[model samples]
Each structure stands twice: as C-alpha cells, then as structure tokens.
Target: MAEQTITERIGSADQVLGVSRREIMEQMIDFYKLGDGDGMRQMFEAYKNWEVRYRDGKRTIDETIELAKDNFDCVARVADGYIDSGDTTVGMVRAVQLPKSTSGPISEFYRKTIDYQPFDPNRN
Candidate 1:
C-alpha cells in the first residue's frame, strides 16, 4: 500500500470526526509550519480514538469535536512552552515561561470573547 499524504490523512480524519476538512487541514498545516509533526499526529490520533470510543454511544459529534479541540489547544500551548504545572485555587494554571506571543488562529479562537445577542425569533 502506498503511504497517504498529510492532506489525505486529514481528509480521512475529517470524515471520521464529522468536522470540516478545511479546518483540519489548516491546523495540520500550522503544525507543519511550526515543525511539530508529533503534535499533528497526536491531534489526528485523538480524533480516531474518539470515533472508536463513541461510535455506538449517545455522544454527539459536537462533543467529540470539542474534545479534539481541547487536545489541539493543549498541544499548541505546550509547543509554545506553556507547561501544566498543576491546578490552582482559581483553576488549572499553565506556567507560561516562553517569551513567544500566542498569536495564531487557535490562540485567537481561545481568546475570543463571546457577545450574546438578544433573542430574535424573526431574524432567522
């Protein structure tokens, strides 16, 4: 069997995970640019594992995507040198020792603040 390219692997994962293939490919490309092949592999593995574990369950695809997102976020943070020391009274505090700015699509997603709009049944 021939080896699959990264895009092919990501496409397969997107089908299994019920996520947008474009999103997965973008993330994989970001990791590749950072030279973090292991992180990209981990993200893909997490998706596969989630599919197997929840294949016959009542869990929704959104839940699985959230789990995958968490894994991706942790890997990205770690790659930027944010080590998880332990939980604090406030919450889990990651020790940010690296001087690099957390500027990326994933970082932006995590940092975005939600603005709630009033319910308008007629809008949609």
Candidate 2:
C-alpha cells in the first residue's frame, strides 16, 4: 500500500513540518527525570520557541515524576507565548475519531480531517 501526502490525508495546509511539533516537548519530562540541567535548558529553549519546526526524537528513558509547585508554576509558562506568526498554517491536530489505518505502525499517524492552525508568533 501507498502512503498519503500530509495534505492528502489532512486535507489542506501551507506546510507540513513533521509528525510531531517539537522534540523538547516530548523530552521535557526527561529533563526533569534525570535532573539534567543541560536537558532542562534545552527543553526550556524549545518551550520558549514553541513554533520551532519538527525535531527528530532522541534516545530518552520512559518515566514520569512529580514537579514542585514552584517548578510547575515555572513550567506552566509553556502555555503562553504561542501566537500565529505567519499567514500559512504550520501544523494540524487530528480529531478524536480515528479514520481507517494504513499499513505500518500506528503509534505515529496523521489524520484526514484537519490542518492544525496553531499559535505562531511570526505573523506580521
């Protein structure tokens, strides 16, 4: 079987950066897990740059832990600073309902209904 282009599956968009928006986001927890300052800094940078293009995933351990109230206050800042920086759409979000699957792994998949218009700070 053949795979569909991002648009063919997602419908419409100016660009399809990658499967996931950012690597730091996925690794944010790792930074906390290892108490790695460097990883934390990198995650912070990635968080600040919310619209950074898709990044390749790196080797990381799977774990979850609790953060201090102060730390959560700090990390909660991630929810801010997102804005549409350009006219073109940068990403998409899949609906809750799953469409029929194509051949291959199902862990990472795009949908056929939407072109995610997320916050981009570069719009002028």
Candidate 3:
C-alpha cells in the first residue's frame, strides 16, 4: 500500500548518491545482458538474495530496472562521446562505468512485498 522507507528495507549504505541501490543492481544486470560485464549478473544474484532477506520485492525490482537503464544510458553516452571524438578508449571506459538510477522497468508486481514509490512509467 505504501513504500517502505530505506531503513525498513535495504540499508542506507547501498543507496547511491541520487538513486536507490536496488536500482543500481538491476541496471547492472541489464548492462551484463548488453555485454557490459559478467559482474552485473553476479550482482543480480546477490541482490536477489537480499530481496528475500529484506522481503523487499518492490524495491528490488524497481532498483534493478533503474540500474539497467542507468548502465545503458552511461554506455550510450560513452558511445556518443566516442562517435564525436573518434576515440576508442571512451568505449572501453563505458564498459566499466557503473549502473545508475535511470536503468529500466522493474515490474511493480512486487507491491506485495514492500512499499514502493510511484514511478512514472513514461520517464526513463
């Protein structure tokens, strides 16, 4: 019915400066899917465990997608930069760029587990 505060669910350290930690992990998985890195998947498994531990389904899914989008956007930005600069290192750097808040669309079905902030589906 209502979103759980970070304290009630995941701890505060996992929260990024602007985005939720769950979002970060989810996005990293997406990045892994896009050939970003294998670590993302590993991170996903870890987060999944945390999801069970905290009973934080909503936050887990929400953050997962957000992180995916963040990773994708970061890579896209690196691609754009390389396109403009003709430098290869930029792409390489993008490969290592961490996930962000604007990752992807995690299912809201998690409402049963924890409180979630209403996200605008239209916004990435």
Among these predictions, the greatest TM-score belongs to 1
Ordered from best to worst lDDT, the candidate numbers read 1, 3, 2
Q: Tens digit of lDDT per residue, candidate 1, span 12-110? A: 653355554444545654765676656665656656465646555565766665555554544444433321222221111231343224334433332
Model 3 residue runs over 4 Å out of place are: 1-59, 91-124
**lDDT on C-alpha atoms for all candidate structures:** 0.45, 0.26, 0.40
Question: What lDDT, from 0 to 1, does candidate 1 have?
Answer: 0.45
- RMSD to true structure for each model, in Å: 11.2, 18.7, 13.1
Instruction: After superposing candidate 2 on the true structure, give the runs of residues whose Cα lies further than 4 Å from its correct spot.
Output: 1-25, 50-124
Worst 10 residues of 2 by lDDT: 103-112
Q: What's model 3's TM-score?
A: 0.28
- Residue-wise C-alpha lDDT for candidate 2, range 56-82, written one tens digit per residue: 234112111111112222222221111
TM-score of each: 0.34, 0.23, 0.28
Candidate 3, residue 61: lDDT: 65
